[model samples]
Target: MNLPGHFHQAQYPKRARWFMAIVWALITVKCGVVWWAMPHWNMPTHPIWVVGPTLIFATLVTILWLAHREE
Candidate 1:
């Protein structure tokens, strides 16, 4: 027995799941990069400065990718 038809229209959950997956992947990859860079990070005086912009760039790219797909 089926319920109301409108219940199936909310696609927010699907998008949310995708968004969460992307976030997790991004975090995991980002951590890996930082881990690999740990030695250089210790040597460079301005290392934190480098990672900040890179993270912003990567996040924007992921945002664009997801936004276009959902449309």
Candidate 2:
């Protein structure tokens, strides 16, 4: 889909796509770390409170990046 005035991966060079992929991977790793450490830290709230939003944001961005067209 074409989204006016929005940033899309296709609008960027191949190098940028790679960079974005790396950034997303790092974010995933961060979520994983937070998930694993949450129990050990004995936090009152569940890990999902923190990791859930990050994952959702990342997934939405990634989907938009892939779905966007260069119209």
Candidate 3:
């Protein structure tokens, strides 16, 4: 028997988008925390090691989230 049409087309996309949004929000919040916490290391070149990874991670996460958006 054929299932409901909206299940495959509309609701699926909405659910996927919702999950993706939550994951992205979590990642953003984590980045925010790291941005402030990194400096406490008291190292002279802390930015090079800590800030660099934070930026790279945020960029990669943003790209992945944007690329796999639901239609």
Tell me, by TM-score, which candidate is best.
2
TM-score of each: 0.41, 0.71, 0.47
Candidate ranking (TM-score, best to worst): 2, 3, 1
In model 1, pairs of residues that clash are none
RMSD of candidate 3 to true structure, Å = 8.6
lDDT of each: 0.61, 0.83, 0.60
Worst 10 residues of 1 by lDDT: 1-10
TM-score between candidate 2 and the true structure: 0.71
- Candidate 1 per-residue C-alpha lDDT over 2-48 given as tens digits, one digit per residue, 9 for 90 to 100: 23334332544787667768876877687667756876657554545
Q: Give lDDT tens digits, candidate 3, residues 1-71.
A: 33333333343467766876787687677766666677775545544465577668877865564454344
Question: Candidate 2: where are CA atoms >4 Å away?
Answer: 2-12
How much does candidate 3 score in TM-score? 0.47
Task: Give candidate 3 regions above 4 Å deviation.
Answer: 1-12, 43-71
The 10-residue segment of model 3 with minimum total lDDT is 1-10
**Ten consecutive residues with minimal summed lDDT in candidate 2?**
1-10
Q: Residue 30: error of model 1 in Å?
A: 0.5
Per-residue lDDT tens digits for candidate 2, residues 12-40, read 78996888889988998999999999899
Candidate 2, after superposition: displacement of residue 25 in Å?
1.4
